[model samples]
Target: MGEWRRCCDNAVCGDNAVCWKSDGVKLKLQGENIQPANENEDLKKGCYNYGVDIADAIVPEWKELWVQVEPEAECIWFGEQEASKKPNGWWSFTFRNYLGKSVIRIKLADGREVVTDPIEVVSPKTPLDEQCDPLFYPKFLRTLIDDLIRYLVSLPFDWEAPTEFATEERTQPPSPIFVLHVLAQHADTICYALQTIWRNPHRRLVTEERWVLLSEASSVDADTILMMLHYPEHLRPYRGNSLSTLAQRLKSKVPERVFERRVTETLDTPENRFIKRFMDIVLYWCDELKRLGYWEKAKSHQPKLEDLQNFVRFLRADPLFADVSELTIFPASSQVLQKRDGYRECLQIYRLLHIARAPIFDRLQDAIDNRRIDQLYEFWCFFRLAETLAAVLGDGQRPYFSTLESDEGGLRRDLSANLGNGYQLVYNEQFEPIWKPKARKKLSYSVPLRPDISLLQENRLLVVFDAKFRFDEKDIQPNQPLEDEMDKAQQEGEIERLAKHADICKMHTYRDALKCRASVILFPGTKGAFHCTNGTKKDNPCLLDIVQNNGLKGVGAVPFVPKPEK
Candidate 1:
């Protein structure tokens, strides 16, 4: 064992075994037994405690070892008196006051050096905390676009496709203008539909009055005679004011005069009403995009905006809609805008409007750029898993997965599969047990168990997976036997030895509390579908095989990498 340890220190750990600083006395590294950072715990920004342990290295009373931080950054280190504590060393340094990724390196007095795995500094959940590397922007946009496209594809036929943009083309290594193009195309379709409805508006006959010229040839009614007498020039043919001649002349001669007459009128139809309503919505979106600062970012879509303006102009110019004025206030209910012939297109347009109006869209760019990376990662996980499961079940046997629902907070999905046999598979996010056992002294309450993805068969949990946005391919390494012993020792110390990977600890909690067959932690990485499993049984837990086992138990971590471009 010493020889192995020596070999490991020579090759891997350098001159001394290096471990992460856990507390005042404990230093943990290279074992599953080491507890991971607590999820519920919060660490203040700036200076915090950090320490490291050196294995089998003799320290003579007082000596200092050099520690290096990569990317060539300087770190403040504690003095020799602090390092003299034989097996372990303590240090204090202020961390960078930002959230992102960094690495730490340690150099021993004997000239051997070891590098720690990448460490992620995460910030508390806030709108301003979403700073990320610029390189990830393109990938994030692609994922968001794919999710949206899938959502559109999943919609029922009644809500026709809002854009001519193909999902495949839009999702291909998205450009800065990609989102703009998508929104533009959607707006263009809506505008075209509206223009079609506006060209030939529905008309109805309405009774109205018009002035008509009456002549002597026209039948002389008593009203006409009185009207003609009021204007004497209308009876100019009769020169004398003799009663008998005037009476005789009145029967024979009368000049032309104007009088009000009833006639049918053509007015704008009900379809115009819907078109007008939709036009207002379009204009509002254009204004809102500008207000939300999307207009500047999406400048490439200026042509689309011009097209919308032209559509609005066309709607306003048509004589049928001459009286159709801008609605000062929109109806609380969309039902007021009745659907007609092109109602499907109108409905689709309304749907787009509804989406644009959502607050998520207002902060969509910010989310894609920073805050929603983890959420997008989770969404991608769900999408990939659902697709994989559907493929395994065959086209006819594909499970029905619900649309991803995202709020200001986060994302969720529901999925179910009926194999026609007695067996069934169901998946849900944030599932809660209907019944919870009551406590003798306190009120019973239900706690919601939210797993990123959960698989079940006939009301039995098969597997639960959590999506972790952090990149750590090394953490996925299988558990070592040395870890078991370390864990036992830690347990005797009255300190629980949780999984060194926080995500794994979370999975462990879900498995024990839910009593599910297995739980897995999923991470986003370049590694292609790596799976590590732990269980007492012989059968390995994969997506397809979990349903057959009666008492399957295990926990694992899988890396979900994007499929390579062909």
Candidate 2:
């Protein structure tokens, strides 16, 4: 008899898949058991010459795959395409301290390989933590532009395609403007992503400075700038990752066209022209003020050149002004220029922008960026989901809405189910027009997950919006105590009951679950700041944390007071 033997009784069955290692024999034959030939086999191929199958790798999808391991097992290296690297394989099954079964996932992939399950051994179980940031990153935010260029330039897609930008060298001085020319079909995605980022409570987008003002419009306020500069860490999933809401919106509400009608043409009535002209005046004044400041006594100390360049580019392209007012560089008479004031001096710059792009003001400028891209994406997901949302909701513009008896009107159907974060989950798009009156009557929910708000947008997409409100100890009205400790403990029973609703919406995962759309939460606002929520699944993470605006129709804020440069 050899030193190792088969621990499991072969007498049990023929060519079975179970192999216990206490026999200390792997790949080696023991005793007179007479097992199959070629005891040692290539693990990756999943079979030994003797039909002994070992599933070493698996295709790691949403439903996690696992491999079992004994306290001491053979080297099961988990590398993607090739067995070149070892992440946990190096530890060599000595992970008892990690727990009884330690499960690790193969993140990326190799097509032919399945990150399958049940290796010859199973370790302890460990909770996997998400590693990436939930917020929209600059690189990711710019991906559409970069990816679009790559996609277009590489039309052939094969090796014959161009490897560099098509604009390289051919276009002189590289147009300062970043133009993304995509198929109109895909235009919604760009706008959708923009709105998503803008609505992210954690995001602070990069935008132009609108210092000019028409009589009706004032200089872009500090609150507006601040709104553009912030984004959230995570956001709820909406319309099942489709920006159709945005697309549908653009279809009927072409912002650019709307702005043109509202700003340029007297569609130009007396009130409008007065309003527009006043903006003209304000713009001229702002420009003059900036230009004056450029040469101000303090100019010697700061980065005025960079500031000047920004101001120049802004005035030239600002959507606020419809024409290059003769006031800016033309050095208009005192009547037009008025007393050279503060930022009001730059008002003349408004004239230049108006003449060039009056018709497409909203195109270059967003309502969210009307110094804000937003219908509010945070708790709701997708700032102005627009047409896509309508499409998702199908024809039912007002779908059903569901909430908990304990909760009131905001988005979070039941806030506690979502991890401390108030927003999470996205539902199907078919449940419309109205939700079952929050009675004990179970509506359409077939799954174990219940979203925050279940309603309809555009009548096609079943919409869900969960609201998250974060209040600091300081911000709570002066009367409320920060910690109502005694009440919280007692409230647990009620909170748990509230959380059971999570099960209500989970059953909607029909064969075609893709249609089972939803948005987890709707953020009204938080601490007078922004709000955000991460989606239920890992794949569709929030674009960013802080939604770009203050849960308003667009992302804007009214500063209580203004201070020069804190």
Candidate 3:
């Protein structure tokens, strides 16, 4: 018998003893469907093994099976088999650094071929708390609201009563009724201020002329001769002749009638006065707000106030505002006020300020007092997660998040990113609604499986996270034999060893029912670390760890601790 014959059994060479047969042969691959490992590991350290099984029932001669892997882009396979040996119908191979799906191909000695189902490799990236700071989200939101408030407060409120109307002449007697026209006056001020803010600097060329008497005549114009004759007594003698005849005696002898003319020029505008006054008013308002303790009362608002102050300074330094006249008060009329765009904008700003201030103030105060942080907490988590995804994916692959109301009246939010590949990542999607048994009598009701966060690739759920807002420490003791403890604890009535067990159990339920590769409970902790645990163990019920086997199921906890005060 050849070496190939030594590897044959009754299973491979049953009826055809002379020829190798491949009739009832099939290839099978087996491994834990779910593989859990750190993302930073390289191919060699991260790779796992899958057993290859060849089932041949009726061949007497040795048969060979050649194995291959398909779609070589995502992964590389090692230990490719061309085995004639049965060896209990199994062999093993390793796959390294693989994600997504790969198919296994088997070729028999008799030129027949078979293929196995696409093997899925699941690798979930670990989430870091530092990437999504809990405090930054709320602070960012508050700053936006505060900026709106500051802008609203900066609008001019005082209006100048129109003392004279453009339609009425100066000769026309002042309106005997003395109408105030408050709206028009206010509108005009707003229009003027906005125009001043937005308009370019005004400039004009100015020329000034002056004349001076000189001892010599540089160039004699008609005016120079007239001046010399009119002031004759002031002239001195030239070339030994009387000053009166010097003009006739000498052509250009230090001519007693000399003239000097200078034309001076400048560029000037009225905008500088306006800009200075406007800056003064802005500074005054800032000082008043500070003096009144508005920013101090809500310290979180100080950053916005400082930003507004800096913007005011920027406006003050702008050359465009240099020529605008300082407007102590605004003048307006009913017709002019309606026609001006700036007036309309100012009115809109005023309305917006009035509408936004009260609600935002109340909401912010509630957040600071911790009276309404529950809703804020949920929002913060959602915002942070979305931001983190966008940061990681970059502009080309940034995801968008949207909130929808489910039929059951619960809000559902999802973040979706298209990788441009065949796959996509959809996070925070709720499971389909279903009706399950609630009582022994077979009564059932709709139950929606809503995880706080879920990551899905194509149709497969990669992982799920539940945000829990409570301490997860359990009171159970480890290493104590249950029999001894049961007797001692029962006599002492100490049966509360399962504290906080429900949290881990709930996580397990999510993992099993959702059919996700892993489920994690995100809770608040001091150290911001990840702990994994298995639900089957009775001891250390709250302990969390990573478990990847039999389809990659795991239950774990990670902390999203709050930022400390500076």
* Candidate 3, 260-281: lDDT as tens digits: 4534332233333434554555
Across 269-314, the per-residue lDDT of candidate 2 in tens digits comes to 2222332453344344335534532112222222433343344344
For all predictions, the C-alpha RMSD in Å is: 16.6, 31.2, 27.8
Give lDDT per model, in order: 0.44, 0.26, 0.39
How much is 528 displaced in model 2, in angstroms? 26
Off by over 4 Å in 3: 1-197, 200-367, 371-430, 434-446, 457-460, 473-499, 526-552, 563-566
TM-score of each: 0.49, 0.18, 0.32
Question: Which regions in candidate 2 have their CA more than 4 angstroms from the true location?
Answer: 1-381, 384-458, 467-488, 491-566
Model 3 clashing-pair count: 22
Q: Rank the candidates by TM-score, best first.
A: 1, 3, 2
Could you give me the TM-score of model 1 versus the true structure? 0.49
Judging by TM-score against the true structure, name the best candidate. 1
- Each prediction's total of clashing residue pairs, residues at least 3 apart in sequence or on different chains, is 0, 151, 22
